[model samples]
Every structure is written in structure tokens, then in C-alpha cells.
Target: MFSTSNTLLYADKLTDFNMPMPHIYACHLSDQLIQFTGPDKKSYLHGQITQDVNLLTNDALLWAGQCDAKGKLWSILRLFNFQDDYFAITSKDEIENALAEFKKYAVFAKVDIEQNKNHQLVGLFGDDLSAVLSELEIILPTENNSTIDFKFGKAIKLDNNRLILCIDKKAQLPSCITLLESEQKWQSLSILAGEPKLNNQAIAEYVPQMVNLQAIGGISFKKGCYKGQETVARMKFLGKNKRAMYILEANTNKPFEATEVEQQLGENWRRAGKLIQTSFDIDTNRAYALAIMPNDLALDTLLRTKQENPISIEIKPLPYSLIEE
Candidate 1:
């Protein structure tokens, strides 16, 4: 059985169970929340992120990106509106750097940007989520990108089977809720779901389009100017984006790390792209990763690692079509 005390420690032992139900799993995300309070919060964010902050409703969540002047992404954010105050979640490791960048423009705005450590991010996956929530008399939003208030915290519906619970650090969950502490399992599900989460290593590396942010409703070309508006707009209108995100699977003796992934042309390997994130299942010896690579590459193209004994990678289809609308 999996215990919350040590989540990843028992991952390899999952196969020993007779038939594991689609257990409700939880993991504390390496995601940090930034609180933006003051009358100018919404207006200030509108000019900084890729998504239109003005369109964010109290019941809906927005997945947005903060990019550099050149259109390269600084960090991907999940913005929430609570009680007239706006809160956004970004990579915990990169929050300090993101805050510094925001400070440059916030000087003129009348908003306060500060990290809120009072809350913790918990990710829940599996078909049992709805039933589990129902037992607590907590109802989740039926629509994707929508949110509802729960007793333990705020639940953001990612899909019918997945949710992201932003809980208060002091609140305790019911004993009926089973927690899965393994970051690997949580990450594997995210990669397989075609969700792109940026980390410290990925900051200021690629633009939103390279990671298919536009396809996931993370970018709004119709919105007013933001930091990278021109660059992002040109790529969308002029068809200038040459790279896109793709999912790949491979077998590794250990686990796959976030490194530069390469592609084979003939006998030589060239730099194809960099990995955004990766997950591994030790029981199956299967590793999954999300990588940004040239969009024009042939479907039969083969990918490998930069190591001397390169591990072969197989291409996998994304959950949604990549066609830009």
C-alpha cells in the first residue's frame, strides 16, 4: 500500500498489489503563489502576461505566460482570482527571479507583488476524484479552466479526472483522502496529459509557441500589448514559429533527466531541442518526456540523448491537435 509518509518510496512496489484502483493521489507542487493586491492588480497584469487578464472571471482560472522582451518565456503562470485579489502560481524555484523581473515594470503600477507562503499546491489525479470530493460534500466545477471553493481549499478542474487543489497550509484533509507523495507519478501524468510545466532550467529559454502554450489557451493573440506581444503576435499572424513541443517515450536504465535532446539526421546527431520535463516508471522501465523541437521534422525522425550510449526516443501524439487556429 502507498503511504503519504513516503510517496515515491513505494512507487516501485505498486506492481505487487492485486489490482490497484485508480487511487486519488496528491503531491505538493514545487509551485509558488504570488499575491497581487491593490486596485491596479488586474490592469498591471494585463500588460505583463500573454493571456488577457481582463477576461479572467472569478469562477475561471487562466493559464498564462510571462515572457521576455524578445518573446522568450520567463515563466508559465496559473492565475486565480479570489475575493477581488489576484493570485498566480509559478515555478517555486524561479519565483524569486520572476519577482525581480516583474519589479522592473511594477514600479509605475500601484500593486504589491509578494510571495504567499501561507498556501500549498496539491495535485490530484485519477477517476476517483469526483467521488472523493462528493463524500466531503465538495462540488467541483464541471468546466475546464473553472474553479470552485472547497472546505480544504480551492479546487481547479483540469479535466474530469484531474484537479489541482490549492489548499491552506494549516488545513488538514479528511482521512478518506489518500495522498500520493511521489513527484514522479504526478509528473508522469502531467507529461502524458500533454501539460507543459516550466522549471528553473527552462526559464528564458523558449517562446510560448515552442511549448504549445497557444494550443492550450495559454496565449491570447487578440489581447492588447504585453511584454512580448509583438514577437508573439508576429509568430501567430505570419506563421513564423518553426519549433513546437512533442512527447517522446524511451527506455532508460535509471531515469530521464532534463537535458538537451538531440535528433539523428543520418549517421550524425544534431541539436534538436531541449527537454521541458520528464517522468519515469521504474516498474515498466518506461520514461516519458516533453521536448521542444523543430516542427518541420519528419514524423519518422529519431531522437536520442547526447550521451555516448544514446537512448532511443519514440514520438508520441499529443492529446490535442497542434494546428493553430
Candidate 2:
């Protein structure tokens, strides 16, 4: 739970942003792009992350997960190529852990990996996004998992209403765009879109499928071996997975945090499972979350926070389906 103490200001700025039309909105993402340079960048990353590095190109972005040997994730990432360097955008807090895992085996590979402080990630959404980009003489990557380079940044289209922009920290944002101070709106969109927002709290907490990464095309089942590939493969082919990430939201008067959700079992509540990520909206006095629970959890079932004063949240339909293509 976080607050910027600008409820009125948020409403004023985003009034049109929330309209049915696609009015543009921007916010700085609490994420960074790690640059992997050197001759073996592609081949090295190919064996390190879940997605096929060969499939990533200047024209496309790919969702990927870097996992530990047991198939537990270090961080889920969006990988792309911008110029000569291959970049992976992930939560800032997990960078060190992810780096430690990546470097252990890289001693024998030809890639040099480090955070690129020169750029910062940003999120864009709302009114006529493509038209707004065109006004600034920039091309929007219209397809999901697609990429395009513009004068100000490398844009990755997450969907019609959302995108992740990697922009130079020193560059001037076009005057046409308004940058919001708080990231709540941006984060809420990602939560609703079913994109798991991992922090240090989430490290090694789940395998990719537990967070619905495979459902989103983040896993490459047909690709050759990578770190943790054995367990990931076994879970899929052997039907060993019984849990998955799901969307949840509820109105709240004050900020609250919880690790688990409780389900009503007759006269009392029983601990269900853990909460992976959460975002609090001060404006609406509501909380949005991504929780990991048994995949068979009934859609009609409601869950309450595992706290003295519990807030109940019902399941929301994900924009995409859980079944993979």
C-alpha cells in the first residue's frame, strides 16, 4: 500500500484518461532495463532465460522468466534488442538476485551484463495511443509483444491500452504527453492485465506457471535446455502444477498488507494461499492484487485478507485465458 497524497490531482489529470476513448497517459515505471553486451549476447541469454533469445528481434519484444535451478523464478522479464545491446526489463529490486544467478554460468559465456542507468522504463496507456504517437512522429508498436524504435525511446506494446517505454533518462519527453507522479494507475493496469509485478518479496516464490507466465507465452516449452528447464518441462508435461495466479480487488478505507488470503470454511476462515503483488488506489479507496492459489479455486468463491480486519475481494476475469496455445 502506497500513497502520494494527491487524490484530487489524480482525478483532475486522469479524468479523461479513464474515458472509453484512448486518451494518452504516462508514468515512470519502477523498473530498469539491464543491458547485455558482447558477441555472445543472444546465445548466452538464450540458455539463461525462458524465452527463445533467437525469437527476440528489433521488431518484437518477448516475455521471459529467469529462474533458479529448481525452476523457481528470479524475475519475470520483458526481453528485447535495442541496437547492439540486448536489454531485459525487470523489477529493480530483483536485479541483484537475477544478476547473481545470471553471472554464475556466464563466466564461460561471452556476454557482459549490467544495469543500463542511461535509460528508464515508462508506462503509457489511454486515449488513441497510436494516434498520439503518430502526432509526435513516432511509430507505436501496435501488436502485443511487438517493438519499435522512436526518437525518444524503444516502445514495447503490452496491449492496446498499455505499453512499456524504455526512454533515455536525459531526453525531453514530448510536450504532448503528461507524466504522472504516482504509478498506481499504471500498476493497476498491469494487475488487471494479469502481468505479475514481482519485487524482492517474490524471489524464488514461484515457478513461471504458478504466476501464469506460461499462459502469457513467457515460457518456451519447445526450446532446448536452459537453467530450470527440466522442472518447468516436468510440471507442464506431467501435470504437476496445481496452483496459479489470479486477479483480485476490494474497496478499503486504509492501506493494508497481507501474505495470505483466507477462505470461509463453514463457520470460520481457513488460510488459502499467498498474495504475490498488490496495488492500493487512494482515490477509490480500493486495493487490487494478484494472488497465487490452487488452479481449481472456484470462480464464484470470494477471498478475504488474512488479517484481523479483513477486506474481501472477488475474482476478476483475466483478459487472456489460462490455457496456452
Judging by TM-score against the true structure, name the best candidate: 2
Which ranges in model 2 have alpha carbons more than 4 Å from their true place?
A: 1-23
TM-score of each: 0.91, 0.92
Candidate 1, superposed: residue stretches over 4 Å from native: 1-20
TM-score of 1: 0.91
Q: What's the C-alpha lDDT at position 57 in model 1?
A: 86
Please, what are the lDDT tens digits per residue for candidate 1 over residues 124-151?
7665675668755678767887888767
Q: Number of backbone collisions per candidate, in order? A: 0, 5
lDDT at residue 84 of model 2 (Cα atoms): 74
Full-model lDDT, candidate 2: 0.80
Cα-based lDDT at residue 36, candidate 1: 91
